[model samples]
Target chain A: MMRLVLGLVVGVMMIGQVAQAQNQPLRLEITEGVIEPLPFAVPNFVPANAAAAELSSDLARVVAADLIGTGLFREIPSSAYISQITDFGAPVQFADWKAINAQALVTGSISVSGNRVTVGFRVWDVFSDKEMKPGLQFSGTKEGWRRMAHKVADAVYSRITGEGGYFDSRVVFVSESGPKNQRRKRLAIMDYDGANVQYLTDSSAIVLAPRFSPTGDRVLYTSYESGFPRIYVLDVGKVQRRVLESQEGTMSFAPRFSPDGQKVVYSLSQGGNTDLYLMTISNGQSKRLTSTPSIETAPSFSPDGSQIVFESDRSGSPQIYVMATSGGEAKRISFGNGRYGTPVWSPRGDMIAFTKQNKGRFHIGVMRANGSEERLLTASFLDEGPTWSPNGRVIMFMRETQGASGRSSLYSVDISGRNLRPVQTPDGGSDPAWSPLQK
Target chain B: MNLVSKLIAGCALMALAACNNPTDGTDGGPIDPNAGTTSPGLIGDQTSPSYFQQAIGDRVLFTVDQSTINSEAQSILQAQANWLLANTDYNATIEGHADEQGTREYNLALGARRANAAREFLISKGIAGNRLKTVSYGKERPIEICSEESCYAKNRRAVTVLLGGLAG
Candidate 1:
């Protein structure tokens, strides 16, 4: 048995040598950059039935757009392909893809029945001449065809990059219109790529800081309809809402959902003093988390729901702090020269993204959960409210230009401080809170 | 500042003469029905809303990111306090605002501080606490349109809007 194992190890080494002599599999280490993007091709998905003829092709297009938008993968246009994939189950002609320098290939098929749709996809490492992963399929309502496409793209991304995917997600934000003084803000939600925008609230009253629930079925936001800041919870699908009860004279704002969606942590001000409070959603009871005289707000929960991160000015300036979920002695985490606020815990539980203000400039930055290895992504005149993508690989925040004509817009930057791009909205937007990956 | 003050005084004097000349009827025209309706006592009343707004200055300015009242803002609030004291039938809502330079939450808290600072001063000057209410608009309401210091100076202000007062 030992001799057989020895011979197998030697054979594996020889195969590795032969693989290196040929083209090795496409391995992307995110830390290394300036490298060429992986080249891949996705033929228009095949339609399994007459009802799926157009949707199959559209779903493939959306999947391709999702992968290509990452800037890590480049799609070889159909014009450049020498062969077409007519059969989803047929053997892949790796030789043809190899000739075109296509390192990876994705082939998918779609089927529709009634209000249901299904997408099946497979990824192949053409260079290694082998399938990278087992075939996968997703079935959902036809109304959510885009989500099915996102799932397929996410599968391909995770299989290739060895990281979680953020494609199948949503963002809740405050959409602004009109002039600066008379600006009307409403709660708006959209897909991760800023498509399918739906206004959850009207522009009747000013709204700020729309945050998504853990399940993405509801949202928490602060509205001024009551002539003062009050937190309200709205069901995303039903569009029904109710104000969260609090003390009569106190104001509540800057709310975020706990990871379990069972409670909410927010800031409440009374008698000109602000503090953090945690409330159980099942019951209307709330417990004060911080009792300092200084302002305390912008509370976010760690993914495990064991601790809370918030911003406080009790130490003389607004800085990030961490405390037990049940409220106890807090420890300051930000020792930087400038003030810090809006610290959002990454879903991965490794880092926290925040907005830092320093010598006449603002930046969207991230630091380790313990407040180490701090890195700034983008700097501008006014960049605030940093929220992590569902996968924690990207951050979305709001930036406003300087001067009178200044308008707010949403911007995202990769965690590596690259691929900074503006998310186009119908009008000005701010306070983006990215939702978790959709079910 | 001096030029604006002089301009305001000149305008007030012209308004006074305009009020008197309307009653003088030196043009010898038929007695205008509207002339009898023009009551200088009500129009120029020190406790009137227009006088409080145009003459006493309904708003006070604050420095960048700080809520501590300067002497100039204190003088304005002091005059406001005197007005509120003389007109016991009036209640005011102090709306604190910040320029579009800071984070929304921080600016909200800062605006609250500015409003509280003004409110505390008014209370110190014998204005009843129950008569004053405070709210922070926090960079949402900007009176000026520019982004420079001149505009920001106007944007970071606390305006004392009279409410629930006696009828004119």
Candidate 2:
């Protein structure tokens, strides 16, 4: 009996030890508080070679520009910096950074050998006095120095925000000019910050809705060169293009690439009836996806190729619908009072961005995949055609003025319905398509 | 034959042909020599392009965001059909347009519906379908550039343009 009592006592002690080992820090409490932008410092990169002397400082400036543009972070100018970082290998002076009230510090170095260049960068948390992430390096041609800088900024952003970075990306949009009645449209591409502007097509034929391929090598757009709307695929690097083979007496428009980039989904109008169609990019083989008499267009594929989210007027008014890629009945996802169209699925596959019109006002909005938790990000005289940033944290769309001027420009807003701002462009722009992150 | 006698014979033959085929409305209505005097208006006859535009009307309007042809639009379309029937030598191209209110793709499809609605009605009114073609400009081309309802009502329309031939 004494041995049994001793065994019970030992079991109780073991249970107490297990419970104590499972103890964790108290969960963070929910409360309202003032939100302020985080302050960070980006020291000019060290030049390891004579050729990289100028590029080193230029790269650092570009990196700082990217982080500040997001509005989530602020840059502490070099004038306020307590100490300079002269060597990338040297330890970070956390006390100096903390003296300037900087929460994060970014340091890097650049080296140019022959035609190739290498950039290495590191990020540190000042209060913690430790590296935020492992230092990383990128190598590329001398011409791509800016891209490498953007890559460094992207890494820093991802580490700090706990979300993917959109710095290292491109945007393809329709550039507009001339008067409101006879606007001339040309296809133009540039960096996400409106740099490196390149015109892909002239204003001879009207172009609309340029979509980037999954690999960022090609773009799909609708052109009126044949006196009717037809889809054309253009190679970004080669600047060569070819019209997608289509049946005679039919019009095709609103083209989008499948997630895999091997197929295109667009709307085909045959004998006055418009429906959704899927076509292989290589051989021109196509299959009909929707057969309703009503118009079905603006199709976007889910990150996975299993389903598609598109706009259809089959329910009498324009609304968002989700259907299988193989073709089946579409479940209506938008039941709000307003008409919803231009449904684009987010890359994260958690939400779908759309254009909604209600009470004569247009709004850019997002909803969960199953159509719950709808939030309107921006409202304007005319707002439509949303394109998600590479990270899916921001939505870029077209916004137009109210009066007879009828000028249109590209604008972006965070998915959480803040930081609404216009994206700068040389001329009036619309129908922006965000490219995937570069390799 | 003598030169004088031959000339007289030719003149006599021309006079006889002219008498046989009289110029019925060949003057193409009056020259309207006073066209710009009392009023600087309408310098052409019934068959002129300006006359067709001013007298018969070239476009029909619809309600906001709708493609259905109401009674007023149907009356205008009926007049258009009659005019087209009278001018069989000419072909028509119907351009569908929308206001600046809707989404681009939806406006395109709506404009197509408007144009097709008008084309089908013209065909039903005995106008040959082959003589008519339809295209939707969507919201790209706006005749009334203002943003008010007054302008939008005029902007949502289908215009029938005469192409001057029967060829496709």
Candidate 3:
């Protein structure tokens, strides 16, 4: 009897140890340095009506592209799926997704009526065998089908990752056509995926460096229509533009709207010297923020509008510098080995995205606001003009091909410096200015 | 000191003689006496004399981040004016360009200012303002495409393109 009791006790203890070992949180052991992209599957969305079949496919594709563009998620190709989703509300077959090694699944449906488009989507965790959150739905014009899809993607991304979504944003860029020597460029805005493009200005005269306001309603750019370089603000809704401040003989460019949209910060060249200046939009009054003889341009406001980051050649080579909005002795923040230009502060306020030129090659890179941990994300013959996605998880910039046959195109990469892909456009593109997410 | 002063005086006397010599006949002549030598003269002789008997040096270079002309540019302008004077019937379009090192819009503005500086210099040198047109190519038309100082030096120049030279 004693031997039986002893044996039973030992067996019970052994079974308990095995159960604890099996349930040890699965030993996720996610390494902090590896920066692996999250894996998710985006299946084709079902159309509520036969007329929406095409739109449903397009919507799903755009959403997947946007999410994958962030480099945070690796899209599991629909070809890998063993099952089809006929309804969004139907329970997902977790076993099927697990078999294909998709940790997350996104399913949705699209309904179109007249000019209206309604989309509904849900994100599920296959491993947990549970819906991550309640279903999300949005409605808009048929023309806004892409945007509705973006919103749905954003919701799923946010719910699963516990971060904001950037898909529902817009991008304003300079559209280029014609020959390289005399390229005709105009300001253009489109959906984040390069759809629904609209030309904001005719190529009557040269326009450069178009920047969107934080609210995404106004654009600030420099135009040669006046036969000189001067700043102009255009209301996106009205398409009417007015000179922000007209100073004769002095050149002003690289204009950025303040976070509050009250002032514009830009570079002004006088007597052959370029410096930065801040101009109050309401009063048309301006103040010279930097008096250095160095070429100071590409001024970007911090997310809180308390500081400004700009590129300057005062350090002998072009580098990024940060200063208080009120203006004072600026501190050098970039210690990289190459020349840096177009230092744009990220919307997230923690990093500054810049274009670095080194060893006859150009790279798009990001670094902390303090100028440490500089990481070169992409390197090529010519890569420049990085614009951050609204959530700051992705960066879209222009990359030009090599040699005489070079063509420029837009590319997006995640903050981790992964998942670089070219954004599709009708023609070549550059100077992407991402808009704020639409409410 | 005395010898130097005497040499300077002798040179001044010779200069005065040259200015006053009516027989020299080089001071003034038929502005278009050779018009018949060229095709309809609307396209004037490849070489023709006119009120503006000078060629404005078609190009000016700017220092980095600067559109201001230096003393070297001023000396070049003196020669440019002579060229413009010889081709008075011609109007010119001054094109300003910049190196690719700068921002596109800023370079455009800088290029304009650089071109304007040349225009102002030509006007100061007795060229009619209406005869000179100004445009900025910014960093678009780089004579040299290499990303080096040697190439950039050639790029940061304002070029004067001659238009409608010396009508009969």
Poorly placed runs, candidate 2 (over 4 Å): A1-34, A113-115, B1-43, B166-168
Chain B TM-score of all predictions, in order? Answer: 0.73, 0.71, 0.65
TM-score, candidate 1, is: 0.87
Give each prediction's DockQ, rounded to 2 decimals: 0.39, 0.45, 0.13
Where's the lowest-lDDT run of ten residues in candidate 1 chain A?
Answer: A1-10
lDDT of each: 0.80, 0.80, 0.73
Report the lDDT tens digits of candidate 3 across residue range B89-120: 45666778887765454466567668878888
Interface RMSD of each: 1.5, 1.1, 4.2
In terms of lDDT, model 2 sits at 0.80
| Most accurate candidate by TM-score | 1
TM-score of 3: 0.79
Query: Which candidate ranks first by DockQ, i.e. highest?
Result: 2
Per-residue lDDT over A5-29 for candidate 2, one digit per residue giving the tens place of the 0 to 100 score: 0011121121111112122211112
Choose 1 or 2, whichever is better by TM-score: 1
- lDDT tens digits, residue span B42-72, model 1: 3354544456666778788988877888999
